[model samples]
Target chain A: MRGYSGDKDAYLKRLRRIEGQIRGLQRMVDDDEYCIDILTQVSAATKALQSLSLGLLDEHLKHCVAEAVAEGGDAADEKVREASEAIARLVRS
Target chain B: MRGYSGDKDAYLKRLRRIEGQIRGLQRMVDDDEYCIDILTQVSAATKALQSLSLGLLDEHLKHCVAEAVAEGGDAADEKVREASEAIARLVRS
Candidate 1:
């Protein structure tokens, strides 16, 4: 996750904005915003969240995961499994 | 995307596997696998894909996007817009 660590501040900022958007969406629901509108916002938030996750996963695979594989320990397989499980969870969700 | 470039070969291999998984999912659909099973596989494939995307996005934000922002060019804003739009598209899907 070397790439991830390089610009930590900016990434966190984006995440904060997305977090606020999610809260705003929740508030919209509380205020009885139109169904489609809420759904639309929900979709946006989901995408934002997904984008963030995608970025992190990409870094993991490119850096940490790859390094682990190169190192070739029990941890390497564990990392692979963890990655797979993460994907599984995403699909199940 | 510096981190991504560093281990390109390994990353491509993982992508190849995911690609195969997606093809398998398509075949399952063609064969009319049970709806739940098909859905399960679809979900898994989606998650696998999302994971891959997330990793790449993370690298871009950390490396490419961050460098663009740091350089302070028109490209910086363009990159930001691209990222936002990417997120929007994901949500819409």
Candidate 2:
């Protein structure tokens, strides 16, 4: 099972909300809203996505990474390495 | 007119694409995809939004902020300050 399986509904809801925010951006552009206003909304949507990423990452570390660590082998090391890379991507993104 | 008025259609198209990415994320979650895979897609979506923001910010600096600065007054200072704040928010987000 995936790390986020238990929180699937919550994650889906958050993604859908972000999707709505993106659509709102389209409407603002269509109406020729001010540049600063649009940028503000963009920042909000970005924050939302970042928040979601952090939540997922937390769960992944708690469950997936923890599970591998408990198993005690090369797979545990690989999982740690993989999780670190994912965290790097999240930070850079 | 907004700084992005000329590129409204392009901006809307990019937002629509990002919306699609968000929906794809919903599907990934619903299917119980691996945590790492979902995080990877999330980063891709975040990057796309950031790129759009950078494009918009470039146009804002070139047009809106440029015009204000050209006029030479307190408005110009305010506009510059506002843009800087927006940039900071984007970076933090």
Which prediction has the highest TM-score against the true structure?
Answer: 2
Query: How would you encode candidate 1's per-residue C-alpha lDDT over B1-93 as one tens digit per residue?
Result: 373797688679988988898898789888988899978887787777776766665555545655565565577567656754554454434
The numbered model that scores best in DockQ is: 2
Question: Chain B alone, model 1: TM-score?
Answer: 0.80
lDDT (Cα, tens digit) per residue for candidate 2, span B20-71 = 9999999999999899999999999999999999999999999999999999
Interface RMSD of each: 10.2, 0.7
**Model 1: which docking level applies?**
incorrect
Off by over 4 Å in 1: A1-3, B1-93
Q: How well does candidate 1 score on lDDT at residue B11?
A: 76
Per-candidate TM-score against the hidden true structure: 0.49, 0.97
Over A49-79, each residue of candidate 2 has an lDDT whose tens digit, in order, gives 9999999999999999999999999999999
Q: Mind giving the per-residue lDDT tens digits that candidate 1 earns over A20-42?
A: 99899889989999999999988
Model 1, residue pairs in steric clash: A54-B54, A54-B55, A55-B54, A55-B57, A55-B58, A57-B55, A58-B54, A58-B55, A58-B56, A59-B55
